[model samples]
Target: MTGAAAAIAALVDRRLTVAVAESLTGGLLVAELIGVPGASAAVLGGVVAYNTELKATVLGVDAYLLAEHGPVHPEVARQMADRVRSVLAVGGVPADIGLSTTGVAGPDPQGGQQPGVVFIGIAFGSTVTALRLDLSGDRQAIRTGVVSESLARLNEMLNEMLTGA
Candidate 1:
């Protein structure tokens, strides 16, 4: 099983559910997790807000923040993470964790940020943090790298949270 799959398994054992929000990584983040068998029980849902404006409309990111810093900002990632968890909440299946990816992975820079600049926001329990990554590659490579790193970090975060470390 993939790292994301194993992480989902562990989360399920802990009775925790997860939701994802994506922009630069698109839907790949969720796709990676759901590919693992039994992930459906722990993986709540995901949203792909690739459009700069849709991040606010669909994920409830602050509109003024979008206009001020665009979609690539760290706070944007944080809000997307938190909002997706809330949006995907069901009566007994509330998402306990949120993961978000937002950045520029392209042949050109965006919002004055370099092309491979990425932010990964993860909310585990009551703590939420955005991690900045400066990747190196073409569009596809950067996106793939983001997926790999985000899932790895998520797995680590889940372990830390579960172990109370």
Candidate 2:
């Protein structure tokens, strides 16, 4: 199965819900999850916080952190992943998994970081992990890479949960 399909199946099997926060990849990450058949059983929703300010005001990322480290920092990804579960909560219950992407995907540098400097954050329960990726390509390629990596990482995390690894 494709990564998205596998991740969706695992989530449904475990009765887990997921929410997404996107910066560099925009809504592609959530789009990938929801594209799977029966994804509604596990995908709660997603937020596209492409604007740095929206990352703070909408998704509750720390403004001070964004100001200090910019949106490409790992902490920013962590907070986006951690808070999005709550931001997209339903009936006061947060999602079981929160995934986020933040980075520079462009032909130009951003926040003092070169293009393809990306971070993917995965949050489950009380644990949040950020994976740094130094991708190389054009804008679209980097964005697509982020989405692929996000799905792969999500599947890995779900597998780990199943095996208690």
Clash totals for all candidate models: 0, 0
What digit string (tens of lDDT, one per residue) describes model 2 on residues 1-165?
A: 988999999999999999999999989999999999999999999999999999999999999999999999999999999999999999999999999999999899999999999999999999998999999999999999999999999998889889999
TM-score of each candidate structure, all chains considered together:
0.95, 0.98
Q: What's the C-alpha lDDT at position 76 in model 2?
A: 95
Q: Against the correct fold, how does model 2 do in TM-score?
A: 0.98
Which stretch of 10 consecutive residues in model 1 shows the poorest summed lDDT? 86-95
lDDT of 1 by residue, 48-77 (tens): 999988898889999999999998889998
Clashing pairs in 1: none
The per-residue C-alpha lDDT of model 1 at residue 138 equals 94
True-structure lDDT of candidate 2: 0.96
